[model samples]
Target: MRAPALSALDIHLFQEGTHSRLHDKLGAHALPAGGVRFAVWAPNAAQVRVIGDWNFWAEGDAMTPRTDGSGIWEADCPQAAPGQAYKYRIVTPSGELLEKADPFAFQSELAPATASRIWAGTHTWADDAWMRARATRNALDAPMAIYEVHAGSWQRENGEFLGYRELAHRLAHYVKDLGFTHVELMPVTEHPFYGSWGYQTTGYFAPTARYGNPEDLMYFVDHLHQQGIGVILDWVPSHFPTDPHGLARFDGTHLYEHADPRQGFHPEWNSAIFNYGRHEVRSFLLSSALYWLDRFHIDGLRVDAVASMLYLDYARGPGQWIPNAHGGRENLEAVHFLQALNRAVYREQPGAFTVAEESTAWPRVSRPTEMGGLGFGMKWNMGWMHDTLRYLREAPVHRRWHHHQLTFSLVYAFTENFVLPLSHDEVVHGKGSLIHKMAGDAWQQFANLRALFGFMWAHPGKKLLFMGGEFGQRREWTHDGELEWWVTGLPGHRGLQQLMRRLNRVLTEEPALHAFDFGPEGFEWIEADDAERSVFAFLRKGPPGTAPILAVSNFTPVPRENHRVGVPLAGAWQELINTDAGEFDGAGWGNLGGARTVPVPSHGRAHSLVLTLPPLSTIYLKGPTRATNA
Candidate 1:
């Protein structure tokens, strides 16, 4: 019940590394005497020492320092430096030898389990450009079309890995060509293994060996910016994989983590959850968040497995799990740490988005800091993804969808900013392709995908589609192998890719689709009937003077000559997009060069939008004004 509070001297430790300002040169405060000075927090420890490559585990190499005013130990050792590799060894009050890294390390010159190095990477960033550009960047509510991909697999040329330079050259154009506004890359931080998918991170500052050198990562990001695309790194701060050669048992003891299994181990993932209440660990996690934001020119971060971080019972059985003092599963320390991380990142790099990908319903994920919220820019709407996928799986095009389930997103859309993503999770881990999820033959499946994409464009929220979905990747994604490249050669899959290109184009040309970028006023339903006609419709309207777009989907296989989509405004309406167009692997029932206006029976409004909706297809109607006004 008594987790001690930070004392006056505890705050002094932060001043050592992050003091004054980051200007033309490294601050003098970073240096501490003859060689290098290393320090770690171990309040109840009997003795402490600094371990590094310099000592070779010899007593002379071991550092000795008394507990400071803040309960932290300091060791003026020769092993510390900008590139120096080192870790901490603490002899606890109970006579147990423990070891961990300098949790406040600017860079892990070696690694968690390895000794220190005196790394001297060259820096050329002025921060002027980064600051100026960040000021005018897109907001959370804007039309964000994210292209999520793993860095290692995205640019495999004949099974060979591409360095940051090669990937920068290739990925930038690939994203721009596909018309995605943002690139949400998988975690790039150095992890000990390749199988954990960067979740079990140990080297918090080092980019992985699999991804080439550290500078290579910088080149990739800078190149992406040059291409007018934003990059978001998937950051893992919640836990670190327990590898003996990594963060676990470094220097000899659990210096950066909790010694007790209750606080130390994460059973489900076989990782070690950070002790957020610890001063050094907090500094480590916070600095890691800021490092990516400041050093990389990265636009944002998609925090991985936020649920695991916020829960004490993430993997606990009914009786084994315990609640916090507040009678909730919420981890207050982790919550506070997250809030601080967001606050620091935003303060240092304004407009830089920090998004959480929590599967469970964590409230106020996108709320402002002043409101007791974590102050994240947005949260992945996993509920929307799950609900929508369920509806799509069972309900036929003509069948009525549970009104609540279909509209459930709207409730949370305004709760905090949201991004509706059909991300890698949809395809990977045994889930079939988006197209395959539909109930139909292969041809119908592709059509279903096209129609669903049309629905995505018409819906009122931000959008994100995983890589292989562009051209209907047939097989479920596998981390061990490449994507279904052969599927692109097939007409059906090729059509899906073309349709994807068209979807982006239309989304860009129309304002209403992106209007809901940050508010509820952006979407208005025009129709939801599934009985009389085998179709449903909706309207996405931006601000005034921004054209309102009507999206209509026909689920049946019968060609309907005149399908009326209700509209509030008037003027010459045109078909902006149709999934059935030849470009999208359909019969191309609509015209490429034409405008049409007709009345809706239900609305009894003249000058309304009408179009030739092909079987199992979707179409968008865009015009100057609403038919009701006309």
Candidate 2:
């Protein structure tokens, strides 16, 4: 290793937490003299030493601390080289000795091992075209149907996991064929426990080695970009697991987390909460976010459990949690940190954005920071998911009494940019599959599931569906096993899969469904109060001149013949999709391919059409573009 070399300004910025790329200056950096320079931040350490394979895991020389008292130590060794396993041995101020892995390591040995590996290779990317046009492709007005996946459980070969390169081809082709615009991966960062589903992150800088090397994961993102599919990584900033080698206690103190247990310890997950008020800790998280976007070319980040970070008393009862300085439950420091994080992310990677998994009615989460908001691009609509699921799980006969649950979400749907997510969370923890959530026999369950997908696609929001949801998998999701791939061969499951493909095709091809997802002007209710019949009908409009598409749903198993519904214009209307058609294992009921509007006034409209309402299904009809009989 060589001697520490940094300007006074670099030290000041790092100390003040303004340095966004601390990885470049810290960790094991290559030296020009055919050696390596290593540095670590251990403020409470009396002395720090570099212990690695080069020194046979023995400490050779003590690293020099910054004279300015920045608490940083550095050294250069001629014996150190790339691919060497290394760690820092620190002598704390209390004279206690401890060894820890590098916090900014770009690579690490696979699990059952905790040593950091020296890596310096950079990946070459061929996705300039995708990068340039990403803004337009990810615009709020454009179509975005995401398929959420857990990498390790997405598929297994011979009961063994597939590498990133192999899964890249497999996952990309599958997503493209399904007509999805993006794939939201569950956390892929390194964590020791396989059951955490990558949420208990230990290596913020390293991609998990269970899949492949860092470059191989880069290839996965690049290949997906080439296929016109954006990739969104699930990022956890709420808290981290208290693994010994992680950021729990460094330098014999709680440097990264809170020193106070009331504020630091997370009771629900048995993890440690980050001290967002600390400058160094905030800089650490900001740098980690940038590292993934800069090195891996990720399109976006789905911030997990943001509500947990915004509240001091989250999941805690009275007297169990400490109040903020203002005597309120709000965590002001974390709010500021999140605002800064969003600002930095958009500034560094233009066109890339973030999503918040905030479950509360926190106002303006997706609004811009300058507008006094959290500044996320969109938010997962947990309210919609919960309310709709609750309503669907009830028996059809009881739906009328609880009909408002289905319509209540529209009242606040446009308050923030929303993504209607039927995510992995819904299918896990004994919740059963989406289809199983429906209350009915085999035939009605399939119909209800298809109807749910049709309604969700037509709703005023972006879309996200978890893996195995396209085809109806009856079992709950488990990290140890792959999805029931054999179920797709079954007739009912295959039909549901086909219905999903068609729904995605129509959602993308028809601008009326996506153009104004965030504004009320895009949606018009023709008959939302028909709770007695458990039926709903609405019109989805595009820009001012474009035609509208009419959607009608029946929650009951009894089909309605000659069901009169309002139409905007008197002309031919094409049947775009029918969830109850025989192809999707439905009762082969539909409007003989098209319907015509009559002069008879109905449902507050000048023109109307008598339609066949299929049992427990939804049908989408495209109205004529030309105006007639105003």
lDDT (Cα, tens digit) per residue for candidate 2, span 403-449: 88888888998899999999999998889888899988888788899
| Model 1 residue 461 distance off true place after TM-score fit, in angstroms | 2.1
Q: In model 2, where do residues sit more than 4 Å from their true spots? A: 1-6, 626-630
Write one digit per residue (lDDT tens) for candidate 1, span 1-630: 311233344446443433112211211113434465444545566776766667765453443434344445555554445644556666666676766544444444422234333444654543445446654545754567888887776657788677778888887887788788888888877765676777778766667657565566777777777677788889998788776545565445575666777667887877877877765567666667777777778889899888888987888866555577888877887888888878877888877889898888788888877898888888888888887777566545534544445556766677778788899888877788777777577777788788888887677667888878878777777666566777787888888887777787777667678856567677765666454455767777776767777778776667787655556655577777888888777877874544566544444444456567787788887767533311
Local distance difference test, candidate 2: 0.89
> Could you tell me which residue pairs clash in candidate 2?
1-76, 1-77, 1-78, 2-76, 2-77
| Top model number, TM-score | 2
- Predictions in order: lDDT: 0.69, 0.89
